[model samples]
Target: MEIKIDDLQGSGIIRLLEEHLADMHATSPAESVHALDVKALQHPSITFWSAAEGNSVLGCVALKSLSCDHGEIKSMRTSGAARNRGVATKLLNHLIADAKSRGFKQLSLETGTQAFFSAAHGLYAKHGFVDCEPFGDYQPDPNSKFMTLVLEQ
Candidate 1:
């Protein structure tokens, strides 16, 4: 599989992001949903990437700059057919390496607290992320769980 930086304009990538946002809303309350739409993902502060095998998109992930030393992981999604195939793991490792190269000291993310997100929690935990207090503009929300990974230089 190949992973490449994306501009959020391709139809396949957009469709996957739409599905991701929809799943977030379906699993979390409207007040707790933080997934960004296509336009939001295209912000200058964010870098989006897609993982594909030739012409088939397997997954996608994004990194959003929060500060000079901190960044946030956003919009991580793997196609249903691609789950359990290490797609997320590969993309996450890529983002972590990229983050370090870009001088980010930490990477954080917000996900749902419900059972629907348990798999995600495990995935992050497996990658060395630990539970943390809300960062950035986030506040304490029962439906939201925050995780952070402190990157080493």
Candidate 2:
């Protein structure tokens, strides 16, 4: 699969992001559902990416600049049809690589504390991310688990 920057306009990506937000709301309280919709991901401070093969959009991820040397991972989701095919991992690796290339000193993310997020927690841990205090605009929330990977920049 190819991973590249996306403009968040394709039909496939729009549908996938909608599904992502729907699941987020279903799994967490409204106030805690931080998943971005298509419009939100298009912000100038955020860079969005799509992983696809030919005409099929397999997954997508975004990085939001929280500071000159820090970025927050946002809106990471794999298409329902593409789960377990390593889509999330590829997108994450791409995001991490981009962060390093941009001279970011750290990459952080906020995910749910629910059982539905167990796999995500494992994925981040496997990639050397450790639990951390909330960063950026986030505050302590019982439903949120924050993780960070400090890049050797």
Candidate 3:
């Protein structure tokens, strides 16, 4: 699979992101949903990428700078047809490597506390993310679960 920075203008990625947003909204209330929209993901502090094979998009992930030494994972999603093929794993590993290369000392993420998010939670834990209090601009929310991994320099 080819993974590279995304332009956010591709129809395939746009559709995938829309579906992801709709799914999140349906599973959680608006107040508890923190997923960024297309516009928000395009901010200067955020770097987005897509995994693809030929013309088919496989998965996508984003890293958002929280501070000079910290970053947050955002909008991680794998296409339905691409599930179970290690696409999400590859994208995640890529993001982690990118963070390290950029001199980030830590990486963090916030995911839902619902069944729909169990797999994601497990994935993060497998990669060394430990439970943590809300970071950055986040406040404590019962519906949210935050995790962080301190990168070795």
Candidate 3 is scored at a TM of 0.98
Q: Compared with the true structure, what per-residue lDDT tens digits does model 2 show for residues 1-153?
A: 999899988999999898889999999999988898887888999999999999899999999999999999999889879999999999999999999999999999999999999989999999999999998888999999999999986
Where does candidate 2 clash, by residue pair?
none
Q: Tell me the tens digit of each residue's lDDT in model 1 across 1-153.
A: 999999777888888988998898888889999999999988999999999997788999999999999999999999998999999999999999999999999999999999999989999999999999999999999999999999999
TM-score of each: 0.98, 0.97, 0.98
Residue 20 shift from truth in candidate 1, angstroms: 0.6
Q: How does residue 130 of candidate 1 score in lDDT?
A: 99
| Cα lDDT of model 3 by residue, 84-141, tens digit | 8998889999999999999999999999998999989989998899999999989999
lDDT of 3 at 10: 95
Model 1 stretches with alpha carbons more than 4 Å out: none
Per-residue lDDT, model 2, residue 121, is 96
